[model samples]
Target: MITLHHCPQTRSMRTLWLLNELGVPFQLRTYPFDRTLRSPAFLNLSPAGRVPALEIDGARMFETGAITEYLCERFSPDGLGTRPGSPNRMQWLVWVHFSETLSQHTAALTQQHVALREDHMRSPIVMKLEAARLGKCYAALEARLATPDENREYLLSSGFSAADISVGQAVYMSRHFATLDDFPATADWYARITARDSFAASLPNDDGIYDRDFYAPWPLE
Candidate 1:
């Protein structure tokens, strides 16, 4: 089985959530959120020094966006991918990339404004500038969700897909530093995803940690 080396409350959790959703068998290697990223083992795995690095079949991969895309292409069940020649495939492809481009950067910028200690955060003027970018991203999502479609439940496809999972996880991260009130439709989309049977199985504790063995308490799907 593939092994995911990760630390809690970090981007690694998103990959964990994706694995759970797919009901794939894998091993989990947990690490603390400190200098472990600088260790020789981790450094050799990911020179960028980040958690959520993945090891599979003797090969290593880094970056949540890249990892998720590769997993979906290589491991997902049939019909779960943005297959070639499918008209909606391009749409899904764009949304998959947009999951990070449209949401994560803005969210992380806002984190600097609100999450850091008083002495650590930058000036209020900088915070306002970051907040503006975040607002624009939220506006795009709200428009999509509100644009009216009889079949508007999922972000793409007739049912759930990896694209939805990517977008959902990104939206879920926004809560750490911003309010969903500003992004009601996006908030509802993420809430609906977490309520899934698969997501409930992978839900982390208040400390934002998920024990792999915890899933073993009951047979995996």
Candidate 2:
């Protein structure tokens, strides 16, 4: 059985969601984010002291992007892991890179988190820049989703793919971007994913860490 070293309501949740989507039975070796990242055992699992590391057949893996690809490749071959020469294989390749590259938006959300923390050193000057940068990113995302009229619900190709997973999580997580009502396509895309029974089973819906308040960097603002 695979063992996923995860923390609640984090990037680690993606791995859990993937596993759940694939109907794979696995162990969730959960640890608290509070000081757990630095623990010797945890560091052995992930040198970066981050969540979402996975142990499969005794091999350890880190990074949500890599882990998501690896899990999909190993378990969901019919879904995300097409061979390199195949035409659809490009989808996985595109999303693996797209997910990582688009992390700028998520970082903006993170900056909001740090800024709002009572002890964090967040200056209004920094927030102004981040808010501006995030605006640009959101606009780009808006344009990217404008393809395929108002009916389709994905970033690329039909139905859901790793692309949707990457973008869905990012957009759902980017609360500060404001009024998802403006991006109906992306909003509709995510609603479908969130409604998936697989997603509901895997996601930590009860975890306060993933709560709206947690993503809000309001106090500092």
Query: Could you tell me every candidate's TM-score relative to the true structure?
Result: 0.82, 0.82
lDDT of 2 by residue, 63-130 (tens): 98888777777777667455557566776567555655445655555655643465356555555565
Model 1 TM-score, 2 decimals: 0.82
> CA lDDT, every prediction?
0.67, 0.65
lDDT of 1 at 99: 74
**Which residue runs of candidate 1 sit more than 4 Å off their true CA positions?**
110-116, 209-221
Global Cα RMSD, each model: 8.1, 3.0
Pairs that collide in candidate 2 are: none
Q: Candidate 1 residues 1-221, lDDT tens each?
A: 68998776677777887888777789998877668889897999889888689999999999887888788888773445666676767767777677776455644554554355353345555555555565676777777666576446666745677777777666555554345677777777777777887666555555553222221111121
In angstroms, how far off is 68's CA in candidate 1? 1.5
